[model samples]
Target chain A: MAEITLDQIIQPENMVYTRSRIMTDTVLHYCPGCGHGTVHRLLAEVIEELDLQSETIGITPVGCSVLMYNYMDIDMQEAAHGRAPALATAIKRLMSEKFVFTYQGDGDLAAIGTAETIHACNRGENITILFINNGIYGMTGGQMAPTTLPDMKASTCPYGRDVQMMGNPLKITDIVATLPGSYYVTRQSVHTPGNVRKAKKAIRKAVEYQKRNQGTCFVEIVSNCNSGWKMTPVDANQWLEENMLPFYPLGDLKVPEE
Target chain B: MGELRLMKGNEAVAEAAIRAGADGYFGYPITPQSEVMEYLMAEKPHERTGMVVLQAESELAAINMVYGGAACGKKVMTSSSSPGISLMQEGISYIAGAELPCLLVNVVRGGPGLGTIQPAQSDYFQSVKGGGHGDYRLITLAPASVQEMSDFVRLGFELAFKYRNPAMILSDGAIGQMMEKVELFDPVPRSKEILPWATTGKTPDRERNIITSLDLDPKRQEDFNLKLQKKYREIEEKEVRFEKIQCDDAEYLFVAYGTSSRVVQKAVQLARSRGIRVGLFRPITLWPFPSKEIFAMTEQVKGILSVEMSAGQMVEDIRLAVKGKIKVDYYGRMGGIIPTPDEVVEMLEKKIIGG
Candidate 1:
């Protein structure tokens, strides 16, 4: 077979190509059929549509998406484990004109960083938070997370999450919505094309609120960890609807009164 | 350029910070130093000079807020007492390790536990030596009076930004609570000085900036530490400062800092009245310790008295400087009890003039 030239191999039309300066060109290390790919794509498309690449600053937390900055083409700051909110607080306050956002996982946000996230939201800082709740610690070999549903089995919870021993799944959106500074709080799932579209809207609204300097806006994307859950992408989405959605029902928790 | 105003040391610090062109103040209220936060709140520097004043929930969050502001290349400050300052040591170490410039003030009260709300100089080692878990040192300045307490804001900020290091103004309950007359000076605006290293953002004309302290490699951290040590050496040589009173022909030298210095000054006067040749060496920069100055006095004075608010803290430094060249005596009062001038004079008579 003849070796294909670089130009011939490139097809911009068939690929997802847009103006998001936040995502880098580095090859993603995420497993095939992982929901992170879908979520990252949706966010990148929204960022491209909004034309916020230059003014956007992404914060990467410690988790499966720890290297999320590597795929984004924009300026990125890596936070200490579970400290994205604190770092974002600094970045946004210092550069108020810049659009700042944090991409965190359930373990990083709901568990180790509970206080940081709560206080940051309570303080009413102006920034967007994109929380990925996968119900388990993916990068750290699938330990249970604060968002792990009851009866969900993981490396740490082989007998399934016992509410008696472990705590109940944290309802972050509901808790954060109670804070007066929260201009927008919504939870979305990315198991279906329709749900992915809805997740995109929630993310877009969050970014928009940040743009308007309204206040803290958070979007929780209930994603699937295919490898950690020990299922194919299709099966994971189906499992999500049957198991996770009932517990973590997705919808807007708060919005402008108007 | 004005008349002296009588004010509490905490209020003077707040006023001086505002005049020092500080754009941000993030602090929590703790006794003996609550006035610093209250003054900033009531005065509302944000309304006049565009300063950002925030009352953080805890000293932990407040210091982190200062860290964030400093990371932005803005002049920020935080004030706390001994217990609160203890909680800030981790963030301070991070700031120093990252080489971010900011100001911190410690209005000390008694402490080992939640010791007391009264005056104490027990944090001498904590301030001069590294309090946090690291091999780093912060530039520590000890103010002996309310006037110097206010004046320290200017010097602390100047040294902080100049060296890209954290500068600390270590005072105590007395200095923070007592009233004194001070002639304040306006701070030179930061815009007047050019700081190319500040992390504003990536400009079209320059390279992208990253403010971080993550060094995964051992060799690289060693190099960074070496550079820090060299910078510290330069600061030791150039910034070490102290006050010397009547030491030209003295038989005894009283070495002290902060509130202890005032006690020594009073004792020196009393000694002179009794026809005794006693002098005082007061260190303004606690970390630098005025070693050369104190070392020079070894030839003039028969013995050095280390008078402090704690149980022989600064005496270690006095002994180190004297290096057995002269006899060293210690006088102290612990647990928030300040040694009176008479107590120091008596120690001098028993330890030096009589011995």
Candidate 2:
């Protein structure tokens, strides 16, 4: 085999990217094998494929992905913890021309902002919501999230998340789907390449529906947090698939039949 | 010119807000001010002009919703009574900290805590003194009549965007619920020239913008506060608004605003009839305090008698303007009780004339 040169790898002509990177090329500080990188890539791919980078506005919630704006090339509004839905509601209402989406964690969506989320969805706002369900608060160092699995270990749940004491993991997508105005609701994972591709499709569809002015599209991406889970990235993915999926089943809960 | 219609003060505000190109209105229903929301709901400005109108769960949610729309660079607003406006202070402070331009209307009511729903001016201090926490101030306008109530909607939006700060229309329950004939300007499509700097989301040509009030560094917060104070000072110099009645040569001038100003108007007429040489100093802009005009009048007048439906609120500002050069006395009736023009004239005659 011929020896490879740095010039060949860095050449502009050889670039295989047909889609523009709406997400910045900054080196993400996520731990190795962290599912955030995969999730971010999928979202960026959807934005690129849909060509929605220019018209899109992302409302970032207070969580690990709070600074997701730094990486997303589109305009971003940082919202108070759990208030992403409220922010998105106002933004979409006022600037109806722009495509608005909210990126929230389980804790932000189900805990403090439950009322805001429920009402926004019920109102059938024309906006997309990307919810990352990791089952723990990664930003504040692994506290128990509203979506934390029963008997799962977290800093706040040192004795493991006991359902009897802490209540069951909230299934927000299903609950949201029950609202008449919620046109599309789905849960997907990104552990493997096939799953990652499916998640990108779901996210792209959600954005497309929002552009069409469909009411309240929600896409939940089940992800892994290695640091929060106290596991390696590879191990975290496996633990999530085996333990998390059973409790939080993935698939389309609501969709407009075409 | 739009078609002229007879309307209440609250109804006019709601109609004018839609005409002024406000994109969103988030409000809660309260006594004496419920007509504002009721008018919006009936007219359905959302369907006609693409405006969004929501009766929020509470005053707190309504204001926060305004905060959200303003962050997106949209012209948004909310109206509430004293108790409700008090609930909105935190969000108001956040809006100010973010330097967002939006309209807030307070239909004044007697209150320390839900004191009474009847018309009162007790919210004077709260509106002009920066009701929320933090070192910031809102541009406040006091409309004494139904006409001014309608007029301030456009003026509040203009000033809010000009100063990149929240602007308030402080009316009382009587004005808010009072009905009168109003002539409003024709509907104007939202002018892009007004707010070119509003956050329109991520465009390929510009960097991402973040609107927030969180400054962890104390020094940075101090610097921000100083900048805000400087802006307020400039507003005092340029944007102060007031009305003068018979102050060219007068011994006693009654200083008041909002609902109290209307009573003072009648009292001035009564004093003039009695040959007491009483004039009225009504501040249209309460935050800037109309100090310049009050000072100008003080050069000729003997003293100022502040009349309000509160214990004593505008009196403090009158004192600051007069600066002990002229005696300043206050007359007020609290907790939903309004002092009539006769009562104010009597007080002036007793305190400044003989008593």
Candidate 3:
């Protein structure tokens, strides 16, 4: 019990973990073990690692993470539901030097904001789009989303989504990948430490391409909404691995020339 | 003195936007007001003043683009006709709620749905009362002449940023498509002043800026609304703009705005020739509605006629303004029809004078 003082132990070389300064002290409203907190942390870490803290602007969507601005210590704009890409287009064009990104959820991006997402991508706007696909509308109490898997259960579709009646789940990332304006497009997840590292690298590289003004760089994070999914946090991750991964597989859908 | 040129109202507005040092214009092509983006594209203002003019995919995207640009405290704007404006309501509400400064121009066309492309004042209620959700108001300016169409571009931005609210030039297709001589100001350079609340990027020196209308708490949202209403009252007090012609000696008054006001001005002359002492009250600012000024005219005139291109949207405001102190009557032509000055005078006689 020799007093090992705090200052002596918290040396730079010994520091293995610390919250990114890019993230504000505000507690994330995300449910415990919800992927949003992890994704938000990754985004803040990416921005911090890239040293774009002062030159970055984040556009948040209208889902569970609409309040993402409260946690990220960066200039931000909260867009109308699904219109984050359109907003990002304008912000990036007017302030081309600023690193701009839009973080959206499935309903906001793949459904109501589909046109904005497609057109912004098609125009080759130099902005990054971070999409969170949770298979259900998490904020509105687990209503069905465009990405809700067929036969999946939701509050609005409690009987489980019937493909014929509810329509097939949209593969917006795949559709976006085909667009020439998409210089880099990828699908990722943050359920595991290994996956988290991969997702962060995707975000960093996407921002890099945006800095070059290459075109639209999109990163779709296949995440879990345990609260909306009506499952425990652990079960949600296991379910995401079994059901979500097969449909929305995690991989680079599009990549610039080697 | 500025450069004088004969230009369409829409074109004049476009050129004036460049001269006003607007940072960007995002628009979609639509009848009557398509010339705005067309002119911007053809002129290549990007080369002229480094202005960013983009043809957005749709009115929805266009207004959102304005939202994004305006949140950064940039001088940005968008133009559309009635149907297109309807599509922008969602974004407009968000902009109003965020209290971001921006300009909008509605070159109105007749509409209940996909109505005619011809000029109409039917959007009067939409612009003033608001076509969007919530208790919000846009500082609306109605330009009777192409000069005002051009001039309002600058004035609209000034008022918008002054109160950090949206300003709209509520013109009709007639003024948007019609041509008239306009005196254009010299091109000013883009503003270099920092907007402390803008989301341009967070500097290490200060806290991050967030632009949003979301206040999950009812009390906080209510307080924000009360603050908004207070600003609106200030605007109503200081920004109500109008012009009175021959009102000092008038026994009757005509209250109108935009294209209808232009025709009503002529009707005033026609009514005067017929031994009727009538004056024209033209509201330049529509949302502040010129209510008090029009109400005060009740003491001078025996009656008021609210002429418009719709069945009678603005007449309701006049009725409220005059408060039954005098007869408040209405005459209008619907579906792209413009009433003749002679016909307008006759109706005034039958409606306000005798009724």
Q: TM-scores for all candidates?
A: 0.88, 0.88, 0.98
Candidates 1 and 2 compared by DockQ, better number: 2
lDDT of 3 by residue, A1-258 (tens): 899999999899999988898889999899989999998888888888889988998899999999999999999999999999989999998989999999999999999999999999998999999999999999889999999999999999999999999899999999999998989999999998999999999988998888788899999999999999989999999999999999999999999996
Residue pair clashes in candidate 2: A75-B202, A151-A161
Candidate 2 lDDT over B206-232, as tens digits, reads 676767666657999889889889988
lDDT tens readout by residue for model 3, B1-355: 9999999999999999999999999999999899999999999998998899999989999999999999999999999999999999999999999999999999999988999999999988888897899999999999999999999999999999999999999999999989999999988999977799999889989989999999999999999999999999999999999999889999999888889988998999999998999999999998888899998998899999889999999899888887889999899999999888998999999998988
Could you give the CAPRI-style class of model 3?
high
Worst 10 residues of 2 chain B by lDDT: B190-199
| Candidate 2 per-residue lDDT over residues A92-158, each given as its tens digit | 8877888888888888888877877888888898999888899999888999999999899999999
User: What's the iRMSD of model 1?
Assistant: 3.0
Question: Cα lDDT of model 2 overall?
Answer: 0.85
What TM-score does prediction 1 earn?
A: 0.88
Chain B TM-score of candidate 2 stands at 0.96
The model with the greatest DockQ is 3
Each prediction's Cα lDDT score? 0.83, 0.85, 0.94
The TM-scores of chain A alone, one per candidate, are 0.91, 0.92, 0.96
